[model samples]
Target chain A: MINAVGREIPDEILRMTGKEPFQGNSYKEGVPFRRYAPIIRPVMDNTHNKMVKDIHEALVKCKAHNGMTVSFHHHFREGDLVVCMVMEEIHKMGLKNITLAATSLGKAHDALVPMIEDGTITSIQASGVRGKIGEAISHGKLKNLAIMRSHGGRVRSLVTGETKVDIAFIGAPTADEYGNLRGVGGKSNCGVLSYSHVDGDCAEYVVAITDTLVPFPNFPAHISMTKVDCVCVVDAIGIPEKIATGAAKPTTDQRKLMMAEYCTQVVVNTPYFKDGFSYQTGVGGASIASTISLTKIMEERGIKMGFGVGGMTKPMCDLLDRGLCRVLLDTQAFDLDAVTNILNPKHHRITAGSYANPFNKGAFVNKLDYVILASLEVDVHFNCNVVVGSDGIITGAQGGHPDTAQGAKCTIVICPLLQGRIPAICSEVTTVTTPGESVDIVVTDYGVAVNPNRPDLLKALEEADCVPLKTIEQLRDEAYAITGVPNPVEFGDRIVGIIEARDGTIMDVVREIKD
Target chain B: MEILKPAVAGTLESSDCMVTVEPGQGKVNLDLDSSVMRQFGPQIKKVIAETLARLDVTDVNIRVVDKGALDCTIKARVEAAVYRSNDIRKDIPWGGAIK
Candidate 1:
């Protein structure tokens, strides 16, 4: 089931090891590629005319063709200019069938449609896409599947050679001529250079594009210049304002606030209730709403949270900033503010393996005091699904839903009983991201349901008159009453893609049903 | 809406009678300067830990100082403390209980 660059992995590493190793044994000796030396130089002297001449020469050598994979990172998030600018050059070069292998797509790449239509690029595989480009991809304008990978998965893919990049276009937030980069010192400052680190190690040619060219040795460097090839200085790398606010704001809907209240109540009544206890909440409207309310309850009752987990966001960033939570064990920064705050030392940006890979020797998830996540549907059996709805269409992305759910002390799912015309509770979930075993509570605006296994919570909440605890069946029925349960989706069996656990075993297969 | 605020393990504040939670061991000797909160601190932390300890706990480290905070306030703070410190939260041999 696992292969890297036409060579099958030894069974000892694949089968004997219980945890599928997501990261390459960057430490262990493995097959190394033969070097194909190309003309490379860091533009320490941008004022010197030789630097521009080198870039023009390098561009001439990397002449493109159909299906040629190109990669970039969103260190600048919405502020990026290199991808579009490089695409303009590719368009000028009249290249077609190019697939953009980005670590993560950003709103800044919205300019790709003209290139997409003109056949300069063909496909994508990264965390998620947004803005006009996302709309374009969602409409199935591209010929191939829009492969979505989590932050860690992208790094894993690039390193393992599952996806090879012909040329990695790295736009530094701050870098010196010798190519050492740091986001904190530069003007843009979006912390966490984990994405580009992998690309630089694997890609054939890595081009460094920068606006702020520091000294030869940049301070607090994330990516060393040794991996970088050609250096190109631009007028500006990105626009700061647009990249900072894209996914920062939380929803303030009254119903969302109502739902958040019930969620906070679950945390309030749980056994983990104590000073310095830790937990994680989703970036969704309902989960963030609960976090803010939980923050208020903590403030009111003179409590402080220990650590926050999973996908980090702005409000959670607020909790981190206020000293409400001591540390943010962040795997992925879900919004602009998180990216910005991660720039500040107040928040920490962690690699995927450190944050959620269950196979790791000591992952932070295993030490979580509590974990609260959002869900698409829950069933009477208590199984939860985040990837698909009743229609079985892929509505959700498997962000960190399963990994943290597996490790937290008190896992709660905070969601509305119903959404749109679909019931949030159903006979069975369309997909299972988190098995119900780890989940301890399900909170809705109307009531809360403690897992049968957690009867003490049930008993105490009963005494405390915490939100009424009902059977999962009752929650589903309530949702059904509001919006009748939809029929199950019919599907075809040509597996479009497979969802594998970090250990690389195929957990589930997503088949492509006729559109 | 009579929202239920939970109290986890923490310290006592004497002046405003507020319980404070500082990051560290799951339990702390609750100390307070204000005369009003003199009765709290260690008393609440001890009571809350023994109460929740009936449920499975892999680890806990907490520090708290309290002043005349109500039972509700104490419980809310205690819950927050427990939820943040330890994460070994699966198939708790048993989970729901109260002092």
Candidate 2:
């Protein structure tokens, strides 16, 4: 932990921009929990019966005696049931202290809460925790630290040998004995197999679980049979229709669209409008609409982007159809349209670790020329807060915002000037997800604000005659002046939770509000 | 020795480009139609991964024919090809398992 204001800087960064005492709350991505996947022989072989049989055998073999770490993929999103069923059997067997290392822990796995209480499970580590499980863990119910990772960071941890899965449970839309699998059938599917692909490759034992047990060869599969052990068969695997409704949706706010317009103008004026530029946009309405508008701008200018990264949406798909963006590197499907597209055979899909994490050997987000995101609040200094609120409440959660902001060459945060009576421009953010250093600009409905460090971006926007430009401090003062001073939030010393940096360090703690 | 055809024309079949692998004999490469291929890279990869396994077509060349399948769809097709190559039945469930 090199002191921000306390000491010297790292040689690599210091050489480019000399070291100084740091005072700001900044983070560095930490050691990953999972290790990198190298070509390894399958620990067990069960290719003849079917992919299901092979999956089961591998899990049983990997955790031979039980009480070990096991993992699963959330590619099924809200439609998933493999993890719960796998755990039910494990719980039935009375296994204790089992650790679940999932790509991201979803509410579908809420049954594990019982296991956590019964001592069958004691720890959890994943990309993000949502819904009921998030609530339970937040109330200090769990006995262990809930380490959240970016998709890329998770891949890196696994690849770097930080987090090792004794057994990995994989579910497919369809599968064969040779361990071939795909996601295009049943109640809900059309998601990436990237998460499972990584888990299967890294875990010591791999269990293939599915409802659709196809013929001798389950044509097209992501998890290769050679890397699989035994397959487990269940009546059905997904929650039918869940693939459509599993995601958080965008809000139809006029102000948001206006902000999106300004964000698009920022891009049109930036260095990302080239014919073959690559970019990423978050699932927020502003980001999505900005991408939508930007695509039209691209079409108007006859410019085609090289690639796009996302959980994905209809707007993103529309661009791809129009020959605007070249590819969509998908890790998670954030909307129904994305799920539908994923089911089709034309969209470009990628792994979670491969799409957003920095630790991965080659993540797609790192190559992005620009990335658009959202924040609950952005301070005058450009530090952003997405996991906490001004009232000291943990209303927001860190999704992929931080990782993308830090990875992209040009990071643009889009939001409204004011949320209801509360001003979005603040003197200091309640919490910092992406440091001011990583943030290049903030595009609000009224205007655009550039970080002090990015003078070039500031100059470019000025030359373009796009939107009103201002420093973040001026914006904050104007917002406060317009909305009257906000009532100061009271705080107590009792910490509720810790927001983790991608690298596994505690960036900041959410303190209990003193009422 | 097996060439799997797509169900629709200018659909999956028309998506095929070229595979000019350098040192890696097992790798698949193509000078893809960026606007088309990029949007469907994720889906295309999914179809291919599954088809490759089902066809039992290991260490072989895979030429894609894409028509803007999302990331997941791409993976599924290649896997189908893999299964078809091995003459394995393609009538298995590729969906998730219910609780």
Candidate 3:
């Protein structure tokens, strides 16, 4: 069945998952609820004493058995070591058929590929997958269909009981024996423990794994001991350098600079370009370039942004420090500078749920005036494919792309005309990660294309008339003229993964790569 | 335009192709390994062959390790490899080969 966005969701898949097809952005109207249950805590001799000797002890005590779900957070990104360590321990203990529910998975967790093949790790639910693990899942080595959810969607899944996490192994940079956790103040400071907050709250067993154990009452804990069930200390939580870079540099590419220039000009001409306007941008080079360009534009106009939100980066931090943006509602810190700056007074750390959860009453993304993001491929219709590549392999994550695109008054997708030889703009993306209606503008190195749905934006851009603007079809045709039309990818009958939009509807399905 | 010696171009990065072209015995011999082989191996090979044919170079051994590069990228890399192998820098048919 075709969804509202025109993505074909196989009936077999619909029958299997019991998820309705995406019925556009306004599908959900009423309040969503979960069956309430009181916390049935174990009778502990001392409530404050929850330290376990090792992961083995924690798993045994938590009654972690085969065929149960386990979760992890990607705060550490490529530096994370806790997931592999815990999986190794689980394998040693003969635990099998476990579902690995992670906020996101990256190259750091490539070691799990063999485990997935061995049936020790049978299922995966994550925002992103990369490296060998992605190859493993794409090849259909795993026993169950991999479920890809946006960050907001993941929280919604947990809260709505669609997915239940048996144990949440949160890798905290710093923690106490009583299970108080913080992302900073450790040997490997990642800044925000926000992604793990929902898991800590919803999971049946919550364990805080840390390399640095502080004294009692880890003050103003990002995750309190109230929700934590056990604490385990490891040699290291993550590779410090890989977790957060020392600096987040903006792109200096000339073509990308032009795109950024256009993005900035579009914002300045928009109705929401006044003082105290809001902003959000992802961590891509082009997006950051746009943000950096915006700083100059804001300076020239003496306009200060009201707030900046999303994954905190150093450029956004610089804006706050320079008094261009009044506040930063950070979900996850992306660099060393961001991690340190988020500890400051003006930068406020927020949970992932509060950052972009679609089902929530209010989200930081909903109030944004502008959001700049990058895409792997965007069709003429403006439907984006940030999840699957041209080859039909899942390589990217849909972090806050859809949520912010739908919420922000103007969402600009910035990219070059082509990535290598593949056209960034296509007739139809391999997967519809973000629907066209939500997208407002498509900005590329060559020209800009305003979604026809937004005639208001088109009129504003035409009046400003500073940047080169073209129809989306023209851009797509220009790209294809350079790179000949690509052959369609052949996929196998087995559905390897399901791409879920933020509202729990099936946006697209990734099938096994045909041999 | 014929490949004179062994030459290489491109990278193993995602959306890129690592292509090595060498002079062969009057016939095209292609050795390809791709991450997207199941879905695009044949297409990658076709792009390579068509690119070489456009350059009018059939006596070449093309070794490609494609990381899901687009056809245009594959064509560009093939042209670069052929030019580099032949040590031809001036008056090269760049646009024609790419087309």
Candidate 4:
């Protein structure tokens, strides 16, 4: 079946997953459903000690078994060590057919490839997969299909019980003996534990693994003791330096600066660029440069941002420091500056479910007026691909691209026309991760293209006459003229991954890359 | 034009290709390794062949390591390597032989 973005979702996949193809962005809007609650074993006595000896004991206490779904969070990113520690313990216990449901996975988890081959992990679910594990999955090493959801969609799946996690292993920076966890005040502080909140709430059993065991009542817990079932102390949860890096420096690349300038013009020219506008942007060089460029304009016009949200970075935090923004609602801190800046009274932490989940009462993204995003590729249809590279490898994540794009009133994607010899603006993307209906504008060094669905925005840009405007087809042709047309990436018949829409519908399928 | 000695041109940069040319066994021999080999390998080879054909060099061994260079960059590098193989530096036709 063809999805709304024109990608063909195989009927077999639809029947197997028991989900509908993406009809449109608002297909599930106003739809009603009941939230799934996990079976809990309440702590009725004060003598119960949730502390466990080690990971093995934690698994035993949680009842390690075959064919069980376990969950993890990616707050530690590339520096994470808990995934490997927990999975190795599970493999040692002779567990088989286990499904690994993580919020995201990176190169740090490549050690699990051996287990994937040995059949300890037969299925996988995450926001994205990278490194050797992605290559393993692309080569059909896993026994079952992998499901890739956005950060928002992952929360929706957990909330609706579509993916019921039997056990959740949360790597906390700090945890008390009673299982109260905090993101700060630990050796390997990552600033926030937003993504694991849902897992703690919905999982049948929750384990808090921490390197630092603080004193009791780790006050203002990010994950409360009431939801935690066990506490396991480890030597280290993550490498502190790798968990959060230094501040991102502004870009000196001329092409990126040009696109950044164009993005600023687009933002300022649009009607949504008013006082107290809500904005979100990634931490890419171009995005940071765009934020810097926009900051100048905001300062000049004396306009203050109502709030800045998403993966917080130095540039956005600088906005708060300069009083250019009123508040910073951070889900994940991308740098050391952001991590240290969270101590500010105005910089508040939020859960991932409240940040982007479509099924929630309302997500922060829905209140966004402008969102500047980066893409691996953007088709003429304005559909963006962030998960798959031009080589048909799952090298990136759909972190909040789909959720924020659908929620923001004006969605602007900033990208260079060409990435090396490959054209970033093409006839079609490798996959559709963000549907075109949600995208309003695409800013490239060559020119800016407005989605035809957003003619009002086109009119606004034209009337303002601030930036060079061209049809998306023109930008694509200019790119092809320079780089030549690209041949289609070869793929095998077996499906390797499924991209889920934020509303719990199938958006696209990733086939095994042909060897 | 004829190959006099081995010569090289271009650098291994993001949007550039390194081309090496030397005397061959009486026939054109081209070897290519590109980051975009899966997508634009044939087109890159076609550009090299066409550029060599225009230069009238029929028997030479050329090796190209491409980091996603455009057609123009490929042509310019291939032409420069062909000219440098014969030590022809001065009085070089900027547009005639190159274009």
Q: Give the best candidate by TM-score.
A: 4
- TM-score, predicted candidate 4 vs. hidden true structure: 0.97
Question: How well is each residue in A1-515 modelled by candidate 1, as lDDT tens digits?
Answer: 43311122334434532334222212222334343233344457646432343344546655555678888877666677778888788778777888888866656778887777666777776655666565555444655555655554465555456667888877777878767776555666555665676677777777777777887778666777777766777777777665454373567788788778777777898778788988887767878877777888898887887888666678888888888888876554556668667755646666555675443355677788788888888766566676544544454455666656666878888877765445677776754545566677888766788878778778878887767778888888887665334545565544333343333333343445434
Model 4 residue B34 distance off true place after TM-score fit, in angstroms: 1.3
Tens digits of lDDT, candidate 1, B64-99: 444444445555555545543444246422234443
Q: Tell me the docking grade of candidate 3.
A: acceptable
lDDT of 3 at A290: 82
Residue range A391-443, candidate 3, lDDT tens digits:
88888888888888988999989878887667889998998889888899999
> Which segments of model 3 are wrong by more than 4 Å?
A35-38, A42-48, B1-23, B32-99
lDDT of 3 at A340: 91
Q: What's the C-alpha lDDT at position A100 in model 4?
A: 99
Q: Considering only chain A, what is the TM-score of each predicted structure?
A: 0.75, 0.84, 0.98, 0.99
Error of 2 at B84 (Å): 75
Candidate number achieving the greatest DockQ relative to the actual structure:
4
TM-score of each: 0.65, 0.72, 0.92, 0.97
DockQ category of candidate 1: incorrect
The complex in candidate 2 yields a DockQ of: 0.01
lDDT of each: 0.62, 0.65, 0.87, 0.93
**Number of the top candidate by lDDT?**
4
Evaluate residue A275 in candidate 4 and report its C-alpha lDDT on the 0 to 100 scale: 94
